[model samples]
Target chain A: MPHDHHDHPHALLPPEPALRVKALETILCDKGLIDPAALEEIIDTYQNKIGPQNGARVVAKAWMDPDFKRALLQDATEVVRDLGYYGRQGEHMVVVENTAEQHNMVVCTLCSCYPWPLLGIPPGWYKSDAYRARAVREPRKVLAEFGVTLPPDTSVRVWDSTAEVRYLVLPMRPEGTEGWTEDQLVALVSRDSMIGTGLALAAASVIEGVEASNQSVEGTAE
Target chain B: MSRVHDMGGRFGDGAVLPEPQDGPVFATEWHARALAVTLACGSLGQWNIDTSRHARERLSPKDYSRFSYYEKWISALADLLVETGVLTLEDLEQAAERAKDQAGGSEEIQKSHPLSSRRLLPEQVAAVLAKGGPADRQEGPVARFQPGQKVRTRRLSDSALVNGGHTRLPNYAAGAVGHIERYHGNHVLPDSAAHGLGEAPEPLYAVRFAASELWAHPEHPGDQVVLDLWQSYLLPEEVA
Candidate 1:
């Protein structure tokens, strides 16, 4: 019944459920049932209404447009601005490009330094000690668990970002976007692309079929 | 309060010592109040704090696993404030109430406020950067060690150092001898120091390791692992 897609234990400590919990516990701890529901409602509104889906749209656009991609690599803050994702923690950002020679992975070895503007709140796993410790020590091994196996010998540099300078991962543009329109390409991008895992959704022929379903919506509108 | 991975003691030439935990952060009354204050003030994103590449001691490992990263920052910040008497627990509760009120009934909730009434001007961020100079520090001795010159990862086993307990300095490349590949510029002090430990603006170096050197993969023996390491972490071949 939690509003978020996943019930992560290490939810960012403030601004959503944590804040709601603190507020409710203070004002409505005695009225437990009523307080919890309100807290849940607040969390759900943010998660479903205004979180990762917003990030997914940016990922999709970058995949389809070269100019946007260039803008993203050169200056993520400006590029994300074009898409309209600007705010607090996301105020400054640099999208690190993942290349064949070098792979860029993000970790806030200090804390969870995330691209909240582009990716929403970080998941529980990101804040876990396991991810934090292993990320800097054995990046390739940990990545393999996510099904991303880097070629042995590719210099995997793990970046530990802070609030002053945050980072977003720009997964390589997937194959099969060729001949696809910008709108179609956007459909192929997903939140995972921004995290350096799972290829763009369109790379799978199965996703191409879903593309047809999307086309129908456009067809009906026309 | 120590981070688990601050195993700077084992790898480098240093002694190991036992570290103790303090207490459950949220379990007690005074502690909970402090936690609440940190959460509220931190939510606003008013101040900047990060300990990435410094050479300072970190909290005990057990303490680290106990709290989330931001929780750690909040704890560190609050503890520093309380230690310095910047704010009191009573002030925190009052502030939280005020923050909650501002948050409600406001169409646009601003997560940040100026830490001080006198806000920094636009040029301040740039000025800070210019004053801080380059993020990367200058090159050092390893530059003296060429591609073919021999070098070994020095064993720095200082239990107090964050990355020192098991193997501080560079974890993977420790104790391994590799030829110098290139000299990277020096960077601002490593996290260990910045957090409150070692020297500042430490020089860094990059060395190349064969795939077989790091991992014995005959199939990919030709592969190479080029790593950027701080100069203090390395010892010249002549010394070893």
Candidate 2:
């Protein structure tokens, strides 16, 4: 009954968001319930140290090194951990490869259970209501939304991360990437490709992207 | 079965729009704090991930829709803390009240106490992050279903469906037929764990259901939905 005027019918609202979190963090820190520096460490870890690049490195190595690919496909968790790309939300890794015969995609319809250690935080689209609700039911339609259209004959397999096991889609290396170094192949791997919502960039597109950037640099110099 | 948060194939939410390439890990300060604090609090081991998830799942349907993603996380954090006796409502209220007028909280405020082993330290963060929480346990019961075996999802009784503790089984796949694609070994069953029934490790398998089996007159012809389902959620697909 703090505020209940006839004209203003709404209940009193809580403090602003930043203040609310600040209040919670303030209390928690005050009680030694949480370490402030640990909070900063987590933010830095996910924001900087971990991300799609780690996954790209894995995929690129798979594309270049057969033995590494075999290990990743066989025991992703140990293989990924050995490569130093293992952590929370990524404890149990199941990497499904995309092939000419079948395309693989990953989604968590009930909640956002993603591979945090490799892919960082999920992109908004992957976590969207549309993607979660429709991806399992109408995957091709969802893929079309992401601008990926597979041939009719190619089977599409969508992995729903319903348990502790997290999935990473090993998108097929695009054609014309022959004799490419692991570093060069890494440049072609998009985050969506690893999520199965999109395909890896074609070799031509990566070359074009490089050329386009160079052109921009030259234009700026002029 | 009709839980507000168990939205899998149900429609009318909206279209899936694309985010610009390489978005920020967190969009706001509150978001980062929400994520960090939730994880930090969970590190205290007061509750398991499933229990924390249940705290979020059992949120009022109205509030579930009203709250944003991180908002839900913060709300769940409060619920978890209060439910686990880590903090009182009065403590939360007093903190909010004291923070309302302040432009920004200062570091000088002292409520210093010795940190527990459960509390994550700054230096331990890296090793902790690298060494993630592994839910996989030693082999429990013998595996029932094997890879490539035809199986159908168990149709939970209406009571079990609505009991609503916490479950990894998505509503859309109930009673649907699929084939076991791979064996993921024994892992914690969230249904039991979330309700304090213990880890109750169970053999898990990736069951691949054709999208057509999940939906009628399917939108996509050959697409398949592979779900990591516990052995308990499955039954042998009896030959017709």
By lDDT, the best candidate is 2
TM-score per prediction, in order, is: 0.51, 0.93
For candidate 2, the per-residue lDDT at B97 reads: 65
- Per-residue lDDT for A16 in model 1? 38
Per-prediction DockQ scores? 0.09, 0.53
DockQ of 2: 0.53
Error of 2 at A5 (Å): 22
After TM-score superposition, what is the CA distance of residue A215 in candidate 2 from its true location, in Å?
A: 4.7
Q: What is the alpha-carbon lDDT for the whole of candidate 2?
A: 0.82
Ten-residue stretch with the least lDDT total in model 1 chain A: A4-13
Per-prediction fnat? 0.01, 0.74
Model 1 per-residue lDDT tens digits across residues B1-240:
234443211222221111111122233333333333332333223332333221112433443556554445444553333333343444334434643675553233232322322222223322322222124435323244555666776654232345433222434445677777544445544444444553355555556555455443322334444445555666787745
Instruction: After the best TM-score superposition of candidate 1, give how far the Cα of residue B59 lies from its true spot, in angstroms.
Output: 4.4
Pairs with steric clashes in candidate 2: none
Which structure among the candidates has the greatest DockQ?
2
lDDT for B67 in candidate 2 is 70
Superposed on the true chain A, the predicted chain A of model 2 yields a TM-score of 0.89
